[model samples]
Target: MLIYAHRGASADFPELTMAAYEGAVEQGADGFECDLRITKDEVPILWHNASMLERAGNRGLIAEMTYKEVSRAYPQVLTLDTFLDYAIANKKGVLLETKHPVFSGNRVEELLVTALHEKKALAKIAVSVMSFSWLAVEKMRRLDSTINTTFLMHKNTPWFQARFSSSAAIGPGMNELRAEPMIAKKIQSLGRSLNVWTVDKDADIHLCQKLGVDILITNKPAHAREVLGYP
Candidate 1:
């Protein structure tokens, strides 16, 4: 199973920062997971929420500010291109999560696809775009069929519905998995890989392993690797 660092070992370092990503890489994580949003300039940047106040002490929405403005306010923020370049240079897989309720139509997806294409990084890295929005998943498929996509869910969206969609994998929250353990088997039964998210505790790690998930998204990559006996 692949161990992906959620927000790049976010438990040890600030989430979505270069420090966190490099920390995860140092921990021997198989890959890194990130959440993204588009700036006013239409450049994709790594950020988890709509507002930057909590994360960066900036008092504006990411969509309302240009990349230069936002970066000036919060220099720690990393652009999609910068992060992708790091991933390619280090030969690490990336699970890129696109934020929902996108206000810029399909522009975010388009920019992400264009960036990957421009670098010719797709052939070298195992990159996958995931979202809670099925429309985004469809848009990703339309943009590039070869690009892997996953449907993220916290609620009980029927497997039959999502499995038949363009998504090649299912990203279920750890809480959802805890609520219904058998869902993993059902997902695997459909020949879809199971990727669980935000798994940080020891018990959660063991549970994901017992379920035979294809990937474990966690903020504690070092701990997870130690638990799983991964180098």
Candidate 2:
């Protein structure tokens, strides 16, 4: 099992800021998981919101603003390309989540794979297309099976099947894991990995490790590393 820094070391710095990502990479995180969303101009940026961009330093929706305007406003507008170039160069991994569920187009997967392919980092990264539609990930495999794509479950927990299933892995929330421990077992039995989200406490991390989760997404990567004895 490995630990992934969620939105970089977001517990200390502002979430999704470059400072947090750089710090997490410096701390030798197995990978950093960041959220991706396209702005109003269809320019993909490392943002988690589909409509909201308040924390992104503006009041308008990212989908309503062009990249030029968004960039001019928020100097920290992390692009998928920029993020991949930096993360892989530092020898860190990435578990990116595409934050475009309501939108049509499948633009999130397009930009993400394009950036990774351009950088030759797709082999080393895992992307989570967090849509109710599982076809999004299946569509990703149309590009590369070895390129990791996982289904991000929202509701109605599904059973796991290893070889027959098109998906390579699954990602559920911490709350989901607690409600149904069998989900963890089912995933492990299927020989696929399970990655849970947004946890920042030592006790929760310990339990996640105990449950044999393959990846733990956390805000405090350095602290989780310490507790998990990564060093």
Clashes of each: 0, 2
Model 2 residue pairs with clashes: 40-62, 40-63
**lDDT of every predicted structure (CA atoms):** 0.91, 0.73
Top TM-score prediction, candidate number: 1
- TM-score between candidate 2 and the true structure: 0.88
How close to the true structure is residue 86 of candidate 1, measured as C-alpha lDDT?
Answer: 95
Q: Pick by lDDT: which candidate is best?
A: 1
lDDT of 2 by residue, 22-55 (tens): 8887766788888888876677788876644467
Off by over 4 Å in 1: 156-160
Clash pairs for candidate 1: none
- Quickly count the clashes in candidate 1: 0
